[model samples]
Target chain A: MNSNMKFSRKTEELVNVFQFLKKKEIEFGCTDRQKMEIDLCVEEVFMNMVRHNSTAKNKIQISVNKTADNKIIISLIDHEDHPFDITKTDDLDLEDYVEKKKSGGLGIHLIKQMMDEISFEHQRGISKITMVKNI
Target chain B: MLTIEKINDNEWKFSGRFDASQADKATKELADPSGTVTIDMAGLDYISSMGLSVLVNTYKHLNEQGFSLRLTNLNRHVRDIFKYTRLEQVFDIVDPTS
Candidate 1:
């Protein structure tokens, strides 16, 4: 099954997005661990788009699909192509980060750690991120 | 929605999903504490990076004052989050059930 939603580029809309994913998870059936991972990845990607692409004009579009082979695919499309590839971000050095007490890169770091497969593309004034996780 | 219950002046309990929207609520709830703060995470099933930032900020704030934060009863999902970020070393995490 596949589900899609459009949300405004605002942080406050996170709850709605969360509920949308949860509803789809219940409908599609996933392990608790997979659900949590997908939730975290979706949140990281959605929030990243909302915050970094604040200048974007259109709503963020997200789709969730569960495959027959037990893989969950999620994609987030932002209308404005800001061209920030989260995959290219360097791995976080925890020791140095803790020393400085900085918090900027943790969200992207978590996404990289949790998702099984992640890819990003920016073209034709659209930035899209796709992530896959197996149950 | 996220709930932060003040178990005591130095201890707090977090329940429900702790995501970006709840950051402000968490920050205000954990603003000031004189001693080492202990957070019970038995009921916290989910947490995002923004939620982590709230705790990290609180930890740093308390650290500068010669205090710190302790987290307990983190489930596998939450525990893996700390482990993956390597934040497990930075914060004191203990599980009495183990």
Candidate 2:
């Protein structure tokens, strides 16, 4: 089964996304570890969209699908025009000291490390990011 | 929702979601404490990048004042987050039982 949802750019809407994912995890037979990773990935993607397009009128759409190969795929679509491919972002130097490390890239870094594969596409004034994880 | 409980002069217990929504409040509640601050995270099951940034900034602020920060009772998931981000090298994460 696949699930789809639309949410505003407000941070408060994250609760609904989390709840939706939790229910999907149970139905998809996701392990606790897989659930945690997926949760973090969703939070990072959703929060990034919220922060970047806080003033935009377009709503974000999220879809989750489970494949026959025991893989979970999540897609996040936003209507904002600015081009951004999180998969192409540079990795943060995880070894840097706390005072010297930059915080800007950590969110994307965590998402990259947690998910098995990520793909991004921009077309017709929309940005679509798809993340896949094997269960 | 997030709740912060002041246990003492330099100790606090945090519970609930520590994500973007609660980042500001959590930072404010944990601010301006003296000495080595110990944060109890047993009840905190979730944290996001915003929460991590708050913790890093707090650690820096306290260190400049000759103080330190300690985190305890992190669940396996949180621990994995730290490990993934290499935050385990920066924060003093300890066992709750110890």
lDDT of 2: 0.85
Chain A TM-score relative to the true structure, per candidate? 0.92, 0.93
In candidate 1, which residue ranges exceed 4 Å CA deviation?
none
TM-score to native of every candidate shown: 0.94, 0.94
lDDT (Cα, 0-100) at B55 in candidate 1: 86
Instruction: Give the fraction of reference interface contacts each candidate recovers.
Output: 0.75, 0.55
Q: Lowest summed-lDDT stretch of 10 residues in model 2 chain A? A: A95-104
Write the residue-wise lDDT of candidate 1 on A1-135 in tens digits.
449899999989988998899998888787798789889999999998888889877899999998899888899999765578888888888789877878678988888777889998889988889998877
Position B66, candidate 2: lDDT? 88
- True-structure RMSD, every candidate: 1.5, 1.8
Query: Which lDDT values do the candidates have, in the order given?
Result: 0.88, 0.85
lDDT of 1 by residue, B30-58 (tens): 98798999999999999999999998899
Q: After superposition, how far is residue A77 of candidate 2 from its true place, in Å?
A: 0.3
